[model samples]
Target: MFEKLKDLKTYEAGKPIELVVREFGIEPKDIIKLASNENPYGPPPKAIEKVKNLASEMHRYPDDSFFELKEGLSSKFNISASNIIIGAGSDQILEFAVHAISPKKVLMAGITFAMYEIYSKQVGAQILKTESVTHNLEEFYEIYKEQKPEIIFLCVPNNPLGECVDAKEVFDFIEKIDENTLVVVDGAYQEFAAHKDKNKEIKPEDILKYKNVLYTGTFSKAYGLGGMRVGYGIANEYIIENLHKLRPPFNITTLSLAAAIEALKDEEFVKNSIIKNFEEMEKYVSFAKENNLKYIDSYTNFIVLYIKNSTQIAENLLKKGIIVRNMASYGFEALRITIGTPEQNDKLLNTLKGMIS
Candidate 1:
């Protein structure tokens, strides 16, 4: 076994409703899982219909070329289909980048997504991170000058922390970096960020000018297609060509491809999900303020609250069939709660209020 594999801890995902049922004996209908940043409304109706309609076609393999899906993404983003590479999920695209670069060192924000570090470690790369929990581009640039890392990961509208950096600032910072270093811009939450602030939007077409940069996006967030497992990366032709070399044929299911394609056409569904997300999110902000709790202003579907006894609170919530993420693994006394539906949020808020008071 590789030395890194011996010590590597498996990535811990949020507790699924099935697992909660098995462990806590909670009834499925009674549970409101706000642990994963899933769309509370679920996948788009069009996607649901597509998946249902394609149920009989499960025996057929998905188009390995992904021509239609790529075409849809290209039209939506105003980029060439040649510039796109589809993945099982954006996480798989991250894996391809790590393998392709075979980097000696990887750089990322101190407390962003965990997969970046996990994937890098699998290839024995030394992981580097910014000192600040939130993204600080100045620190990143300084470190880049000193370290000359082979790969740098910028997770815009950063996960867990729920903060985003301005796109102009990011572009300016990238302009200073050496071309030998590949910059991976993970915008898994970009749809939400762009809806919240126009300046936070980093267009694939705008970034495609740089051969060294790759922008990754997923339909799983705002599109409400988390189960579909569809994601893609947009870059200059050269980058996409190389990444495709590592992709497995028919990596996505036939149903997933169709669902994503249909989800792309349902603009109203995505818009409503983002709008409802922010509307529900405001309630969280208000609850935090009314209770005098500190929180990061969220650009994404989830919010992190810096609270006392977060572990205890999380445990209590879990007992009551309300699933929320405890930030103890990230070394913080906080809770990262996904914004749920109106009724679900009320249940969480009322339950939380009693515990804290």
Candidate 2:
């Protein structure tokens, strides 16, 4: 019976350090994983201390509505709590968006995050993939007119590729789309986007301009809170209300909510993380230039480099106790590596230099 379930495709996740250690018989301490774009600095000290203090109350269930977390985010973004909804992570909110609107046709870029395709299939939607080496608004508009999709997913500062659509262009595209269609801007990497004006960061007020627009973000990347899985979405209260109807009660844990509240208040943590990412990105760029390897300019915490035999390169690196992402699944001859601390970046660059030589 299991064999007859042929409507499935495998989703490849970043290989865990422990699993790689066992597979290659290497010491975990010796491995340098540049695969997932995680904050190397870890969570802020204040957030860690707060969670530790909250640990004693483990027996109590968390607020199912995530009221405090939502309140904090709402205050920061200047939106009513009614317009916000928290989840285990922004990925869950992305899944909710797909589930709510994409019962049939879904549209996304060909090289966007894998989760978009995964969730599309899960909801039994036909994913219409478009090609984009860059986010040319005209190209997107052309496809939008043809597809007339119920839901269009846009990952600004697109993953793996790390290119974002300009704000004015994105707004223009939204204006042209049919009012009945829902347009979602996935901002998982928005924290690192290099908008000329810093104010380009998505604000709750921005989401209100377009009734069909929904913006999602997470604390996993810049906040160094991946393990906690806290993320949220902003939209008109109507859409948020509908999402609340579909979301599971108590989907987020108490500790996660507590940690996120502290994390949001630690503005210094976010500032330092962005500064560190930029510094590390420069080093990666220098390494790529010195080695004569082609790569994409990134506004995110990871950079993608084009290389022949990316899978073979990854396999060899794994044996050497270095882990990097291979883009074989996304049909690109490239690898994506997270920008780590300066020390970790040096180690990764040194290892890559030797491998390529």
Candidate 3:
């Protein structure tokens, strides 16, 4: 009965604070979770208030059109509402793309966002991966010429590893591909990448000009709305129209829509979160250096440190009321730690010091 799902491996998210509480008998208040690349500062103040105000509207369904949220996104990106498609999260958008395209062959990085491979497998498509751990356009081109994959996924400022490819390099690579091949640029960490390096920025407007390119973004990271589950894809009107067909009615909740709409209006909150993220990231970098540990120079809200015994260290940290992502599942002996607030970062660093030493 579950034919297509037989080989599929479920995506394992970062250990949640609640899970740590249940498993280790640690109080939620005492646990500092650096596992998920979530905004440790919490959601935007305005978004929080909006969600509270929207609490009474839970009985009603969200607008299927999602016109208001789309409009806010339209104005922000200078793109028409027709060019966008909202999803439960950017990962949902990835699913929509995979289903809509129904590709025979899919291409992605050797190590990238797991959803790319997971969704492709669901559709029974053959998956092709580049040899390099990070995005390499030349290697991608070589594979593209030989395999002619139907869809390509580029995760900028890629997760787990934290390295980014130049936007121009990405565009150049996309330009060489035929119009029939779809290229999905997963920019879940785009805001952080842009803030860290101007060369890494890939604007929605620019992406829209390419008919085959779909740029996906999420409010879960820099926008501090991880709990809201709001994300979107920007492309030409034709691609958005097709993706809409696969979208379920009211895929997101009323409160989530309200939270995202309010979150979009508070640019200052997003800005400050990004600013603090990098500032706190510097501390992690310094800590890595002090311990003589090698780490990827991250452009996202998290950093990945190459450790000799990451799994043991991560477990030890959990016992001390700190939770970090051990990248063992991704085939790396490293830890992907979300950059947290100053106090939170300090606590994590101190805890890590005792473990590593």
Query: Which residue ranges in model 2 land beyond 4 Å of their true spot?
Result: 1-5, 194-200
Ranking by TM-score: 1, 3, 2
How high is the CA lDDT of each candidate model? 0.92, 0.83, 0.92
What TM-score does candidate 2 reach? Answer: 0.95
Each model's RMSD to truth, in Å? 0.8, 1.9, 1.0
Index of the highest-TM-score prediction: 1
lDDT of 3 by residue, 1-357 (tens): 998899999999888888889988988889898888999889999999988887998999999899999999999989999999999999999999999988999999999999899999988999999989889889999999999999999999798789999999999998999999999999999999999899999999999888899999999999988888999999999999999999999999999999999999999999999998999899989999999999998899999998878999988898888989898887879999989889999998988888788
**Ordered list by lDDT, greatest first:** 1, 3, 2
Q: Write the per-residue lDDT of candidate 1 for residues 203-313, one digit (tens) a residue.
A: 989989897999999988888878888899999999999999999989999999999999999999999999999999999999999999999999999999888999999
Tell how far residue 298 is off in model 2, in angstroms. Answer: 0.3
lDDT of 2: 0.83
Clashing pairs in 1: none
Question: Tens digits of per-residue lDDT for model 2 on 50-118?
Answer: 989999887888988787888888888888888888888898998898888755777788778778778
Error of 2 at 7 (Å): 3.9
How does model 1 fare in lDDT? 0.92
